[model samples]
Target chain A: MKLAEAVAALSLEVEDPQILDREVEGGYCSDLLSDVMAKAAGGSIWVTNQVHANVVAVASLIDAAAVIIAGGMQPEEETVKKAQDVGIPLLSTSLSAFDVVGRLYELGLRGTLRDG
Target chain B: MPDVKDVGALMSVTYDVAARDFVRAGEAASKLKRLLQQLGLDPAVIRRAAIAAYEAEMNIVIHSYGGQIKVDITPESIEMICEDSGPGIPDIEKALQEGYSTATEEIREMGFGAGMGLPNIQRSADQFRIESTVGEGTCLQVTILHEAGE
Candidate 1:
């Protein structure tokens, strides 16, 4: 699913200019960095309420396609800019992390067969 | 992929993980992930490598003074050696238990030091080894297999 499409489907208002409509292959929701790093499938869209710069860094490290800041949270300026610099689209929504993740899953965005 | 018997086919990479710097903790793992991608490793192997490297990286940041993770990859498998020179784990058995951690309040606020680092590493690697001294340091060896056709 395209990121724009997902955002629209979720009825989320995209406040950040850095968001682009890249295809989101899958979705993983977690606030624990270790779990995310260990278990997040590649090319998956990440949904979390954590707004720290390290969250951006972890998403990039795990090769997550994009990051959605759930619960209407906006990241710090440095975090947003870093996401832009890394070419990873960042989004925000009022939905809780689980709600967004459930929406993605209900839309048939499930686990992907990650390729090299 | 190159044959393991061919020594020239072996590729090795090392990353230094600093301690107590929560901001820079996951940098080494991120670099390793990028290298794995550039090398065109299998996604499964890449994931395993990421998990191992991440746990090792977290250990350095939360527990030890500092450490280094050295990865040697071949067509057959990837071998990792993580060495730390910080205050070692006094009770390996207790430390191995899930939900057991000695992290400070400051560390917990950052959403880490949950005591899952070692267990995550063990779960991710095909083979695992750990050694530590109470006042000295710690070392871990992890190996993950990439069997034929995997």
Candidate 2:
């Protein structure tokens, strides 16, 4: 699925649409940066509760398809800027992390594993 | 395809990492990823190096005072050296263990300090080494080699 397609279908707030057409291959929900780095497969839609700029950094390093800040959390201005600067798709939702992941799964995005 | 010739000509690159600066933590690692991408390195190898480099960069940002990440790239391999100036790890044995971190509450709240950083880096690199002085600092060397088959 493409990020923009999912965002429009689910009504997710597109915080930054720098890479809306980017491919969304998988999904992973975790707030732990190391865990995300170690296990989240490339091009996954990373669902996290972190609202800091570092979230953008992690997403970029792992080449995530998009970052969904769940639980109604809004990232700081710097985070949105960083995401835009790096051409990463940043999204937001009022749903909890679990709910967000479930909806993404419903949209046919499965979680892929990367061996740590 | 990008100029593989440029990647072959590459020797070493380095970047400064600021301590406790979560905002800019993954800058060096991301740049390294771009360089590898430009070289058209193996996707699997590039991902491994990127993840490892990110974890190493985060360690210096979360634990040490400040540091530098130096990377050397070739068609066959990538070597990264992360050296930091801070209160070094008192026990390498314990620090290498998963789920054993000394990060403050603030860091934990930001979704770090999981004690998985070092372990993750070790897992991603084909060869990993660590050296630290109690009061001086810590240094990590990580190398990821690419296979011909990809």
Candidate 3:
């Protein structure tokens, strides 16, 4: 699915719309940057509540499709700047991380396994 | 035949990592990633190098007073040297175990300090080495080789 469709389907606020057309292969939810760095697939969407610049770094490193900051968390200015600079779409939702993950799963977004 | 000296060239860059600076922790790794990408390296190799560097960078930020990370990339492989000055790990074996950590509450709140940094670094690198002394500091060296095919 395209990031745009996922955003609309989950009612996520598009903090950066520049990358809405990027392809979303699947989803991986984690707050730990290392886990995301070591496991997230190239085109997967990352669902997490961690709103920091490192999050952007991990997303860019693993080539994650986009980052969805859950629980209505507002990212720091630097975090948003980094995401925009790296051309990764950053989204936010009022729901909790679990809720967001559940909704994305229901929307047919599977988790990209580490080896797969 | 071409000059033997021209067979391989080494490029090195160094960045300073500040302790407890969560905001700037990943800058060094990000720069390294950009450099690797511009060099036309394989994407998987670049990702592995970036992950190892980032993990080392975060360890310095979370545990040490401060440190320096120097990345030396050659035609054959990428090597990262991370040296920090602070209290050192007393037991390397214990520290390498998953889920064993000495991180403070503050660091844990940032979603790091989960006892995965070193393990993740080791997993990401083709070669890894570590040395430390109590009340002094720690040094980590990680290398990721370019695969034979690429």
Candidate 4:
């Protein structure tokens, strides 16, 4: 699935629409940056409740497709700026992480497993 | 053939890290990763190196008073010497254990302080060594080979 499609389907608030042409090959939901680094695969969309700038760092490091900050929590100014600068779409929605994940699953996005 | 006098360092850089500077916390690691990519290192190796380096950077940002991480990259390996001055770890053994962190509620709320930083670095490095002295400082020396057998 394309990140734009997912964003549209979920009505996600994109921090900037200039960088949503990525493919959503998989997804990983975690607030812990370490966990995300260890497991999230490249091209996977990261779902998290964290709005810290570190979220942007982890997402870009793993080459995540995009970051969907769940539960409507807007990210810090620096995070949004870094996301734009790094070309990772910083998105948010009123839905919780669980809710967003479920919606993404229904949209044909799958979670990435370590062994897979 | 004669011995090459200076073939050890392909590139080297040192980044200063400030304590509790969450706004710019990950920039050092990001710069290091970008350098590796520019060198055209294997993507997998770059990811591992970036992860370890980022975790180490975060440790200093969240825990230490201030520190510096020096990166050394060669043809075959990447070496990071991360050092922080003062308020060192009391128990290296306990600090290395997963699920044991001294972070405050604020740090935990930032999605770090999970007690997995060192272990995560260990998982990403080919060689990892950490030492610290109370009231002195902490020192971490990590090396990740370019051609990891992953």
On DockQ, the leading prediction is 2
The TM-score values for the models, in the order shown, are 0.84, 0.92, 0.92, 0.94
Predict model 2's lDDT versus the native.
0.87
Regions of model 2 farther than 4 Å from truth: B1-10, B148-150
**Candidate 1 wrongly placed segments (more than 4 Å):** A11-19, A102-116, B1-7, B148-150
In angstroms, give how far residue B137 of model 1 lies from its true place.
1.1
What DockQ does every candidate get? 0.43, 0.69, 0.61, 0.63
If you assessed candidate 2 against the hidden native complex, which CAPRI class would it receive?
A: medium
Ten-residue segment with the worst summed lDDT in candidate 2 chain A? Answer: A15-24
Extract clashing residue pairs from model 4. none
lDDT of each: 0.78, 0.87, 0.86, 0.88
Best by TM-score: 4
Q: Candidate 2 on A1-116: residue-level lDDT in tens?
A: 98888898778999755569888889999999888888888899999999999898888888899999999999899999999999888899999999898888999999977754
Better of 1 and 4 by DockQ: 4
Model 1: per-residue Cα lDDT over B1-51, one tens digit each: 111232587888778887877566667777777777888887777777787
User: What docking grade does candidate 4 earn?
Assistant: medium
Q: After superposition, how far is residue B28 of candidate 3 from its true place, in Å?
A: 0.6
Give a tens-digit lDDT track for model 1, residues A1-105. Answer: 788888778886554555556777798887777767767777889888877777777788777888888998888777777677667778888888888888888
| Residue B21 local lDDT, model 1 | 73
lDDT string, candidate 2, B4-116, tens digits: 33344555788788988877878888888888898788888988888888888888988989999888886567888899999999999999999999999999999999999
Docking class of 3: medium
Q: What CAPRI class is candidate 1?
A: acceptable
| Complex DockQ, candidate 1 | 0.43
Clashes of each: 0, 0, 0, 0
